[model samples]
Target chain A: MITPITETDLLLFYYQEADEVTTSIIREHLPENTDWQYFLNELATISSESSSLMCSPSNTTLSIILEESRSQLEHTL
Target chain B: MNAPIIADGVLIQRYMQGNQAAFETLLNRHRNRIFTSIYLLVNDRYLAEDIFQETFIKIINNIQAGKYNHEDKFLPWAMRIARNLSIDTIRSRKRMPVVVDSEGRDVFDCLGISVQSREDEQINQDEISALKHWIRELPEEQREVLILRNYAELSFKEIAVLTNTNINTCIGRMHYAILNLRKKMQKNTVRVK
Candidate 1:
């Protein structure tokens, strides 16, 4: 009997957190399931697009952090 | 030949042993993701910077004090500290974060876009701003799950632990967050058309 897939399963599968058996099941099921295929594609597109939305903190903040670390080292010495 | 890339655990060991450069390498490597994660949670640039600084300071202190124990899983461990600090600041302020600054700039305005023609850049910027705005509009729980999963690069299991929810719940929230985002994007596209 075929196991029914949940949206949670699809999500885990997309994130590569699914077990090997579930991964195989999803891989086998995707070819025969257009809806799941579309969902997976949407998940992939969202992941790809959102991954680029990184922003850096200001230089001053970084400088301060490094200075704090240096001070800590001095205290330890 | 290229030098072998050192793992985070090794870098932590070096930093703990008085090698500041190792800590610098670690900071430079994960700075963007850590900053962005805090910014998204707080939705204020200045506040985000403050929290980011605090997060790293706490990390340094923890490492020096021998409180850092998560081996090789540095980003997620740092992210948990960042997340907690952001949440504490938000709760203390007793207000939800706004999507735009006082001058009406987008919270994501600091994100770097690829170089392109002015017109194309404008279009791309507008689209990214809209996407980020939609993300900011999501329910707090859903947005938290999405940010932790995507920006922090935490596994669902880690997210579940961080958020104090079960793994299935984390996965479910992520699924709904993606679906909600897609629906909002589709609706916006229809309106634009």
Candidate 2:
């Protein structure tokens, strides 16, 4: 019987975090063709959007400043 | 603004030694990632921009004053500052009770993203939008884990370090996130048919 993959199991696979046995099980049980396609698509879509959200403009500026400040400080000290 | 791409550690060493150009290089390399991190937390582009600028200023001031430390962990440390500030801004709002509700709403509403990827054309726009929207509704813990693990391509150990969480908890959160997303997608697919 081709058991449906659980979210937990799928997550481990998607992240390449699962052990070989579990990974093999997931690969074997994965939905075929369009089913897997849409599944992968959905995961990518959400993850990308959330990543875009999490990294803020302020964070970028801070990175810039940190880089510059540290460099400048290194030179001075 | 314009500097060579030196390693972060090297840049930190240079900064500590008073190399201004080295500091700028580090900032340029990481600005976008850092900005996005802050933007996610606050969900306000304008406020995020302000905070982003402020974070740099604070860092620069600290460095000049010889107060900056944690050489290797600088980026994460700065991120910690940005996160704290963004959270503080949310708390200080007049409608503080409603902030969480509204932040989630705003993020969810924007789930319909127009991806500019080459393969995007192959995907149905509505379906893509729906999928993205559903992911947005996931719990913050799950969402963060998903982003770190997938989007940022951070390993569980790396994510654990970044979020100050354990590997098991990180994996668990990611599991729940995927599970919720899968359930939502299944429901949506059924509704469409």
Candidate 3:
């Protein structure tokens, strides 16, 4: 049986430090029914979808914060 | 009017010179990454917004007061503020019983992730939510490393500096985090099946 990929191996793969052969082996052996697949999928890209998981504060809220924060900064400085 | 593309340092310099547009550009550029990092840490929407505002307020005031450094490295500086504020909020909230279950899609630790388009994402919502649940359940150190690496997109070296720890320690924490998460997810899978 192929050895299960360790945490270190997964991290190496995540960071693109793993050689192609190792990652390919991992991809082949890693079960599709695990959260590992989910995480790898989620983190595989640097897109806004991955970021939405991190909680994207709305643009309206951000705009208000920016405006109010500038006012506070102006008053303080 | 089209805003001239400027370096982060130039943006800061212009903002310091009372150019509101420059400051807006800078804030717009970095808000999502920085705010998302803060939210993942605190796990509260209003609190995250408060800390985000306070962080930018600090940044703007500091620059105006001539106390800001790290020119052109705006995100890290903003991120440091967000991190500090988040830590303070968490520390102060010691005993707040409620934990956010991956966007409150569930009442408790169980969360449902809605599948959405994200640069060719392939994971289903259930798996993604399970991953989120496991992530939030990880120890704070490990979770912080995960958020920095995954959400903030920070390099390990940058994380080490921000967390004020060694690289090996940070890496080790991330390894343990992922391992522990995998272990839990497997258990969850078995329970469901």
Top candidate on DockQ is 1
lDDT per residue, candidate 3, B3-110, as tens digits? 677888888887776677888888887777788788768766567778888888788778877887854377777788889999988887675566565566434434
Error of 2 at B23 (Å): 2.1
RMSD of each: 6.9, 9.4, 9.7
Tell me the TM-score of each prediction against the true structure: 0.83, 0.59, 0.66
User: Model 2 chain A: which ten-residue window has the lowest total lDDT?
Assistant: A52-61
Query: What is the CAPRI rating of model 2's predicted complex?
Result: acceptable
RMSD of 3: 9.7
> In angstroms, what RMSD does candidate 1 have relative to the true structure?
6.9
Position A7, candidate 2: lDDT: 56
Which 10 consecutive positions of candidate 1 chain B have the poorest summed lDDT?
Answer: B110-119
Provide the overall lDDT of each model, using Cα atoms, as 2-decimal numbers: 0.83, 0.62, 0.71
Tens-digit lDDT track for model 3 on A9-72? 6776778766687789877866863756766763453232344465556676778767865674
Candidate 1: misplaced stretches above 4 Å?
B70-72, B95-128, B190-193
For model 2, the stretches where C-alpha displacement exceeds 4 angstroms are: A1-13, A16-77, B1-5, B62-71, B94-136, B147-155, B158-164, B185-193
Q: Per-residue lDDT for B1-193 in model 2, tens only?
A: 8955566777766766767776677677667666666554554556668777777777677766767675436666566566667767767854534222454653422553322232244234323445444555778788776655554456787778778889889988986877787688667654311
